[model samples]
Target: MFWRLLSTICSLTSCLNAVRVPGYDYFDDSYYYELKNLLEAPESLHGARGDHPREVNGWGPGLELGQVSGVSVDLEGRPVIFHRGPNVWNFKSFNATHHYQGEDGPIAEDPVLILNPDNGKVVRSWGGGRFLLPHGITVDHHGNTWLTDVALHQVFKFPAEAKAPDLTLGEAKVPGSDDTHLCKPTSVAVAKDGDFFVADGYCNSRILRFAPDGKLKEKFGHFGGEWSDSGLYVPHGVALDEARDTLCVADRENRRVVCIRAGLHHHTFGTPVRTLHPASRARVFDVAIHNGVLVGVSGTAEEGNAGGFTADLSSGEMLGEWGPLQGFRNPHAIAISGDGSALYVAEIGPNRIWKFTVGKTFLPTKM
Candidate 1:
């Protein structure tokens, strides 16, 4: 009788499991496989002589530009990558003109949107009028998109449905001069309360804080090399750790990641409790916090080389590093999957995105 009862329970559990989980039939493997093939074949993705290279140099730095700034996954599970080219004048050599033209001279290369890894499809892209040189991008909790334009020196908020961004803040009213409002804002992070943080990278080297209503709350950091300090040298990326109520900043030029308690006085920047430095001279470009681990991408100033690394957010201990996969060329930004099992890297120089998947537990180990 007990054996029979166990058998019945097992059968019922199996039925429940099947009902709870959806099958993979909707995700046709053939479609994804074919997409991968297209991405691997440069000719299919790139435009004509003036065409963009689908896998690399599709947006033109002549396949040699290195400036991937931000990467994220959309609500539909598609990957979004952002980059800023040197300047629009440089694009003339390639016979590529700005999507938006002006007599005052063309703005820098606007953000180019691309589908997730191994799929070189150019999804919907719009940002030329709304940006000078878009350096970073993030989706807020409300599904709104936020972007930082370093050359424009401003942070812009765009409604999810906006075909062209309507400036929610930092237009002609930025605190500093019209052109000096933001000192090279690079990365953005939205807090639970809708407040956002901007890493004023490159020029100013500070973190600008703003409320949901677009008022500047406070700003932190300066230019320096001190430890656990507020001063920064070319801060590039920013992330908020809601669980710990801390703000993590990627001090790119300093070659370390810094953390500070949220809502602290700007001048009282706390000491960094953790630091991540790779053995080589590669500068850390961007970082994302996932499951208490900080994953970052690193590369040299020159082209043709870049890699990724992971470290413990709590202890600052280096976990592991891997790279040169899927033709990764100067990986600048990284975004992890919701389940933390997959990672998407943006290759700026190649103008491509690469996906890396962790082996599942049920998979057999290789000999």
Candidate 2:
């Protein structure tokens, strides 16, 4: 009610310097949320460089994993992921009317994978049963792979040695919010003329855009309206910096990482051309921008932390973190390697994929 009494009057106090109103500064009026004064990450770039080119070793086949949400890096740079073979995203997976509460089938195994970035193995695997809960994975710039099935709330597009999906986009099992449905479509970003960007995740926290022949061209966020900082709650990942056209999102419940000015030559959305909170208070699920670096990743352990951080998406700073004291627990998804020197991380309870390197190396600068 009234945003739960303004989140209990912003947790009983400094509601971000006495709650200033007007077009309101998101986060201060998202009701209140700051967490030990954000922005830290330095100690010469905290815990980074911890290696593991690939851990779980046991590539595909007899299935059995269930969480490594998503990771991407293809077109000869290998890596691709998207786990949950033994399926597990409880409360009966997909609800809120976005279909699938059970038995919409598929999850028999091959929830796509393709490691081997120097010995992670699994040379290549195909999406068996063709997905249901597998979260996100994009490999554009020509090797097309795209996926994003929070239990089939749709979004797919596979092509190089295709297994089927010519380009799918919502509706197969119906989720909603106009222009053909897409409720939990967490993450997808492309555009070197293929123009994609979907992060229509978890309910209706928007941000769409399509047209790589999939239609639905525009629809920026909304769904939190209360958790502002330019709203969007479970927007769990989306990236595209095609040289400053920007779009980066991973606004996972406001832990932040939001860039704006969407692609196709930017239309300048009212606000959020930058917003990065970093320093890992956890929850910022996925994001990756290579070269000028933006790589984020956080996970459920939250206040108890989880791994990843690295900023400077055009001066939003924060520049580095390695979370939960470096054991890096849940780190959902992150991909960076278009010569930004490796760094593929996808970890959702043992469904591993690590591979770090990146000490410094940018010369692809756009900012």
Candidate 3:
């Protein structure tokens, strides 16, 4: 009742705190949106499945990282993974309040693992008792690690060599749509300038942008309607292409990967600039961008189309499709090397990590 009265008495700008983004005078107009060739996705998309990417066998041996939620590479080109350790997210994991119903509290094993890229040896492992139901991760250009937890409904930032998170957003165990709260925030993408974007996928169905100091800057997105230009359903992953000023989102439930403007200006802030669809049945899970490539991985066991595709990040042209030579059970998260030579994918059901050499030479399947 108090909020309702205040909203009625105040203008829209006065009701909520606003942070102005400085750009050219041309970009300052909120009434005009400049959408180029962007279009809404069709009801059902069909395309040819490209080639198979030979998966390297015996990559990360003896590493018991369970249900790898996200993967990224650090400055030294080492693979870093955020996982659930021993905890599994099941149907009964969360109650009606989106709170953990488990009696185990938090998993005992370390949730973050840094590995040697060449032989896949666990070099550094930490982040124990710091998260619940880990969901997403991004290792930035500055070597800062970003992570998200659906159970806690929060996002955290662990500085390059820091033991604890120097920055964290969202209330622990609390969920709300206001600027102070995030509900089931799945992924985060940090730009070179320290600005970042978060996909509040589950509860709010919105994409939020924040400044380095953790202030809400701008946001746009909606829920429902499969073809809605700004609609987001289960956005599981986000990737920022620093060079092209493009930010691609793995719109999981929608079965497509969409790109939007990531810099000082946007055509339509929420509208997709280019939409790339995989095999119609595949549910896009995670995406990685590098060079001129955009790789999207999907895992839909029920659809029987669990695989991935490589596309032109700028033109949305289908370049290739990838999967394990032994087939993927339930691939979850994907990460690309800084040089765009190596691709890493993690699976949940079989609890496996795969390393794919982008172009060719690799150790063949050992019989």
lDDT of each: 0.60, 0.71, 0.75
TM-scores, all models, native as reference: 0.67, 0.30, 0.81
User: What digit string (tens of lDDT, one per residue) describes model 2 on residues 99-202?
Assistant: 77876578777878787777676776888886768888888889888888876788888888888988788777777788887777888888888878788888
lDDT of 1 by residue, 126-176 (tens): 565445555687776666778776545567787786766655554431334
Candidate 3 C-alpha lDDT tens digits along 63-179: 766888888888888888888977889998888877767666676778888999988889998888778799888898899999999988999999998988988999998888888
Cα RMSDs, all models = 14.0, 20.2, 21.9
Q: Which 10 successive residues of model 2 have the least lDDT summed?
A: 29-38
Winner on lDDT between 1 and 2 is 2
Off by over 4 Å in 2: 1-78, 82-111, 119-127, 130-151, 154-182, 187-203, 206-228, 232-286, 289-293, 296-341, 344-357, 361-367
Model 1 poorest 10 in a row by lDDT:
45-54
Which candidate do you rate higher for lDDT, 2 or 3?
Answer: 3
